[model samples]
Target chain A: MVRSYIPAEFIVEVDHEKCRRCKRCLLNCSFGALEFKDRVTPLHEQCVACHRCLTFCPEGAISVEANPLGFKYSHNWSPQLRKNIWKQAETGGVLLTGMGNELPYPIIWDCLVLDACQVTNPSIDPLREPMELKTFLGSKPDFLEFDTGADGTLRLKTKMPPQIAIETPIIFAPMSYGALSFNAHKAMAIAAAEFGTVLETGEGGLHRDLYPYKDHIIVQCASGRFGVHAEYLNAGVGVEIKIGQGAKPGIGGHLPGEKIGEEISKTRMIPRGTDALSPAPHHDIYSIEDLRQLIYAIKEAIDYKPVSVKIAAVHNVAAIASGIVRAGADILYLDGFRGGTGASPTIIRDHVGIPIELALAAVDDRLRQEGIRNQASIIAAGSIRSSADVAKAIALGADAVAIGTGALIAMGCRVCQKCYTGNCAWGIATQRPELTRRLDPEVAAQRLVNLLHAWSSELKEILGSLGVNAIESLRGSRERLRGIGLDALTLDIMGIKPAGR
Target chain B: MKNGRAKINASGIYYRELNRMIREAIAAGEQEIELIGVNGQRYIADGIKQKVMIIIDGVPGNDLSAFMDGPTVIVNANAQDGVGNTMNDGKVIIHGDAGDVIGYGMRGGKVFIKGNVGYRVGIHMKSYKDQVPVIIVGGKAVDFFGEYMAGGILILLGLTCPNNQSIVGNYLGTGMHGGQIFVRGKVEKHQLGAEVGIQEIGPQDHKLIEPLLREYCEDFNLDYNESMSRPFIKLVPVSHRPYGRLYAY
Candidate 1:
């Protein structure tokens, strides 16, 4: 029996009169849902309705219509049944998605609500209240002292190392050159420079075009060690040695030779159309001593750029983080399991590492116990959604936060999860010329700035109600956080007291 | 060689000297020049235009012929990784073993390595009409040989390795849907993708190897007759059935 198919979310529609039959819509559609039948374009039932084609149509022919009424199903099992149908229509396997907050698992954002200013305490106006958003992102000193030089000039002698000052604590994470378009990378870099923060160039070497903003960039050195030269190492504000990524923790990435175009090849310093293979293990690094060698090698190469080591939140991550801190690293970036990726194997992304919340708490507790919490600053990534998560991460001992998926969403990503295909409909993930032109660097940078501004305002509101003015005062202050409806083990793991205690 | 008389003392002085000499020669429309530098400095003769000859004395740094259009760089010593990355047209003759990613993503060029090469040699190489890239590795390669190769010719001539030794490593030609890989030695226990077809080298394959062998012999001082006497194995992608029945219903 043939079943009649009906779509619930018809977020995209096309006007036949306005379509010039130029096939621009077909090229923009990553899902291949649009096709020309007998010279008339038709939208298939398999459309995710991302609205990318509608926005790119030059003739302004596309319009979206909501599903008609009386189409709703009474059975509770209907959503799952419809999802199965959609999955079968697409890959005939399981439906794959990219860059969205996971839904099935309980989202921590929804469980925790921000406390607002009440009548008892003066609720200052958001515009008038002096809120501090300045965040420092480097190692701190243990003791403070003063010394007098021979010239009798009073000089403060302390081991307090310098930190990166951000007007807002939010930063754009490194997504790499091959994963996203150059326009997208430029947008993030420009936005970070404007916002008084830093942007990360993930593993891919710093492109020559981005050299002008070297002071605001954080260059990464990963396992493949692509595009790493003396000039590139010294060009950035900090150097990040990527031990593992949140998307696929142990697995390495392979950028197929077809995607290695001239620009990407030059930026990565590899051959064009050659598979950019990031090896699983760093050949020079076998132990912590070996890791120290690489760290000092880069430091010696670049003359004291703040060196950071980023690792996925795996088993025994606390112990590993301690080793990394003692290995002469200035910072530690911990990525959780639910992080997004441009391309990762289906098996690895689903089941690999621990949650960021638990990992952050454990690492903080371990560092505090070792009396070395001040040796390295902590930056938490992987599924940071709203301003509350940022505040919560700070309370859990994070000096700052890095956002990848959230930043992409602010730049107009629907999270269709087809990033591995390198045909991103929103012009955020692909290297295709026509699709990449859709994302304007200036406009996208504004959207990022706008998102950060809104989040910063929200962060101030939450901090004022908690009776704190600065973010530094809330570092590892778990007394302000209380868990709701959490079990004993979960409460212990999160290191938070239950509500109404 | 007028620029050779100028003494360069700095560490990264080779690239500046090479660029200045090449740019001056090209601006005057001179086609032939010689670079005499034996230092292990980086990025020598990078981004040179088509129709020029650069003879190198000492070892060069990583990315020797990066973004080279149509110039020939003849190296007297061993070179580094990313030898001919994104090179549109040129020839790089190395009289010694080259580093990793040799002929990486090279669309139109000929790289003749007189000795063995490192891992991932000829990775992602392709060819267009009248723009074929040829990478002839004179000795054994390490691993992942021709990985994700889409097009072009990758010839592995096991001239330097001991007898009865395997010329390539595990996962040879992984994800290869196009191009041809010819190995002169026995390929034992190597995993080939389903899209590739392996067979014994035929008479036509010998004809193609003859000219390349002659070029290798002249460049690296080897006997062409001694190199070609051994049996050769040829690898070609199964064009008719690229992927397999797995993707087909």
Candidate 2:
């Protein structure tokens, strides 16, 4: 399979005059892209632009310059498209990448404009007032039962539907130990515990070290059913039945055997060097009734633990969400096509599921119209980057939002999209002991906590500007949002009005 | 069943309530319990590590001992689907025939089935450290027996079969990665999955097979030597990771 290779997209050039010849760049590069021939030459073809060697160079002598080699440009045949084709043609393999979808699709979050209060309705001062981000997510009952007390006063029913109360609605989304590392899981768990939120243990099974964070973890029972035992199910605030993920909606996830190293072998309870493949659909659950059966099975196992169903934001997400609500799901998590993954095929990542904004709005409107909005709290996820995006999601009817790529960024991910190679220099997505050891749980956890705190403060500020003291008031309040540079259809589907109306 | 024990009259389709009652009783320090009218109430003894004895009179539902650890569950009648799914450690004794997919992903436990099991039995079962799952089915098994089994022991004794027309069904042990399947009687060449092939029982295998069979015969009230005298073959995965060749770099 000797095929012609394309020149590297970005080439690292070393200034000869200031080279210093310390060889720190060659020593720090995990990809071995830097060659120390005469004075630290670079085999740029292997460089994934991880920014590791460049960032650690003691002497400011190296720079990564984007190659001027441009392909024959066509609207349909861009440089990336040509490069991808050439790479596949050379390797004859399915192209694997990481991080969120990088397609230039319409970002509705940027188009959404948040409304502010004026003259008659003055904005609340968040600093002076109690800007409560406190949220209770669960099924809210329709009517209250009043019983006469001994004092001849009416009292409501003593018991109410179960609610998962958290200070902020941001949950640490499920990222598996095999895909990432134990340190990453610890970081997420530590951050979640500090932030008074939940951290999910993606179907790779909870590491033994994370058992201490049991109260803060959400164990996922996906199709693989790896390392799932009675204690695994019980050791969590909730159980998430992963029906599908957003990156590759219909396809399953395959954490290659190379990634299933020593610690992961014990954590996932599978043999070392065995692929941790999550089947696309659960063989036990073939239909909606089967889904209900498994859901109840988990409920039966955990008793009263909150059970959530995570589905990709597909075309019929509303109808599917209705069925999920009817099936007694306390929470429905919708992941858009832009959702990140450790490894996914290029085609599915680029074109598969729908956007989270439209899906959230549609499901919210459908649930409200069907009068089952209170039955399940909607948590939107995909590419929720900033607190303003979180506010937009809340206004569009998401009770809470989850972040994956944003969390990785907080943990020092440069979005190099080379995570599937198991050579992540940032120590966030790789499982190699050397790379994994580079990530300090304490430091990453503190950074994540700071990011979440900043986002929470920004959320409170946005709520105050909207004249709402609590996040609940802005929930499903589509009138508080206006669409900018959006088509009429998109605006209608999103349940928002055009600007200046 | 025992003194100062708890008993639940599970007559309806309220598995949640039944499980809650079982949990409360266990939490209240009741070790031995009995459920009488257990007809298709799924997840009977799910996700519990308490050292208790649960006795069931009737047919328990699907996923009988799913994720169960440490408890000894005795099903007097037949057991249904998904017995001992991803089980950690426990003992499940079924007095009668069991349904499909028994011991699915069973990590560590002993599932003694007295009758024929259905499709995909012991699928994706794995062993971790010293925790090896052991399943002994007395009767014949249907299609895809032990499909994609990653670890543990699967024994199928074709005791009640009329004739030897491959007591096991088609596509037996398909995609089996790691595990040993012992079946009585001869299986046709086409009946085997791609990743597995049958070989004569060796002396080293006898050590592993003898004790498990002795226990199975003891539980079913059968002659151990007479059962062992019959022709037996062992099914072992050609490789630990069978699909490794397809997608490896």
Candidate 3:
């Protein structure tokens, strides 16, 4: 099928007088979009318009010219496509995407809509009403009892260790240090602390600047086991072992050596200029039993701090999650296939794992059925676009929701899909000093905070309409969900009945 | 004197009593402890640093030796997953079956299992000269047996259950650059990586096995002579160079 050729969105022009022909731009471009014709570089029509050539030109000869008159569309699409075109125009860089399948596949978030409050139940205004978003992430005691010591003073016998408290259920998902810029991580940390939530330092070790936000941070220990030590383990309120990521299921992470700066090198405890590779599997763990050993080891090391196990939502994710909970994890962080990544193979990102919505529903149902739902708290992350997705996730079985790509979007990421190149224009995904400076942590943090506040308000509104005052009440409450335009098989898998049935 | 004995009386629930008991044991400075009355309590010896000996009579829960250091955990019954995870220095000996990731990211110490182990036994077991870790499996293991093994020694005796003939799953040594693996069977359908070299276990090989076999038999009470009678195969890296033939440059 030969489609009509469309003109490039961005055309590169080289200044003849300033052209040095060092060929540095050609060497750096992973994508073969640049070619040398008579020792002068020419941009090919296949360019995705990442603008790396323009930015890296030391001679200051290259300039990008956008076509004022956009290419004519052969097939007329919906209003969403038009909006996307305008969005692409606003940001000259190719759409930088995080999180899963955005193609017009059926979104379960839209299928499960939130009901607005009516006259029967007064809708409390968020401005005046006190909406509770506090969440506790840890095991809860079945019953409370008092034990009398020899001294006759009463002490709680069945008290559980205190859980890390969050003023909001929303949290920043773990995006590795190499995947996003240091400034981006700072933004997330500052914003999370300000919002009384928590931000995760992905598999990457916590930066020195982020040490102050220790109370609001969750450090992750992954398969590579990078930068993990007594201090790193004890630095955060909670520690998470990253079993897998949503964007690339069954695959480990590889941070190209070029991205490893001095600070990143120090923080991660890896040699400078070495490709930081996370092995596909953690060597110590061979089964569910081994997972338990690691869980306990971390627990003991940190004096019983909350330990979370993060896994991608695969075909048997429910069963795997059940095993993880049985393995003694305090929290289960499920990343749906559509989750975003700083750098993942295109094949893995597009073709691995199930949707977050389905995985969450199935896992919740499985856990509840097995009577182990209370063993661990579930935090769902993938492509949670709006507040509606958050509400749906909680209703489907998640105790809370985590935002990654959405948070990046809030922090001026245009989803240019050039993160793999390490020349991010928005300064969110690159390590280059000049590029990274574009994203100011202060401004970025404020934007993130604003986005989270809006989502929190929307979540409260949804809970209010469902006759649930607290976010906790909405967790695992499948009664509020109904399938729409989905097949019988999908509906069954999701453990929900079709709408109007 | 029997001190630091933590008793758990549940199958799946991780009660506060168990946590308190473990905490008290640590606080009391008891180096060696025995956890009795355990029937699959999750996170049994989680993150314990004290040089302790935890002898579990019944089944222990998940994450048995997470971040464990300088201790010997002996599980009498079948154990759950994530054993010896990120363990710097320690030894975990399972009398019965062991779950997945038997020695995941184990920087130091050794893990010995008397019976069969689950998948990815030595997934990322790296060695730093004097800190080389080892995992000796008495019985067969599941697939992806030694995926991404950078260092350490993984010994799998083809002693499968009476009903099965296979010792390990397919892709036995994928992405393995360093480390030595000793398997007993012919490894017929298994695929090995380019960086691996396979050879029949000769007289010289038996010298290496003598000490490991003696230790395995001593720990699990097996007949060393009977175990050594079976045919064995040795797996070594193709070259001493760790980063051999990965890139064009």
Name the top TM-score candidate: 2
For A1-501, candidate 2 gives per-residue lDDT tens digits of: 564566787888889898899998886788878887777888878888888887888788888878888677689888887777787776677777787789999999999999999998999988899998988767778767889999999998656877777789788888888888788899999998888888888889999888988878889988888878877888887889898888888877778788877888988888788777666777666778878877877887787677899999999999999999989888898999899998888888988899999999999999999999988888899999999999999999999998888998899888888888888887888887778888999999999999999999988889899999999899889999999999999999998899999
Which regions of candidate 1 fall more than 4 Å away from where they truly are? A1-46, A52-95, A113-131, A140-146, A150-154, A158-163, A223-230, A254-262, A269-297, A345-351, A418-425, B1-162, B165-184, B189-249
Q: What is the DockQ of each candidate?
A: 0.06, 0.48, 0.20
True-contact fraction per candidate equals 0.00, 0.46, 0.32
Interface RMSD of each: 8.9, 2.5, 8.8
Query: Model 1 chain A — which ten-residue stretch has the worst lDDT?
Result: A94-103
* Candidates 1 and 2 compared by lDDT, better number: 2
Best by lDDT: 2
Q: Name the lDDT value of residue B235 in candidate 3.
A: 80
Clash pairs detected, candidate 2:
none
The most accurate candidate by DockQ is 2
DockQ of 2: 0.48
Error of 1 at A41 (Å): 8.1
TM of each candidate vs. truth: 0.69, 0.95, 0.68
lDDT (Cα, tens digit) per residue for candidate 3, span A409-495: 898665766677777767888899877887899999999999998988888877777766788877777767788888899878776
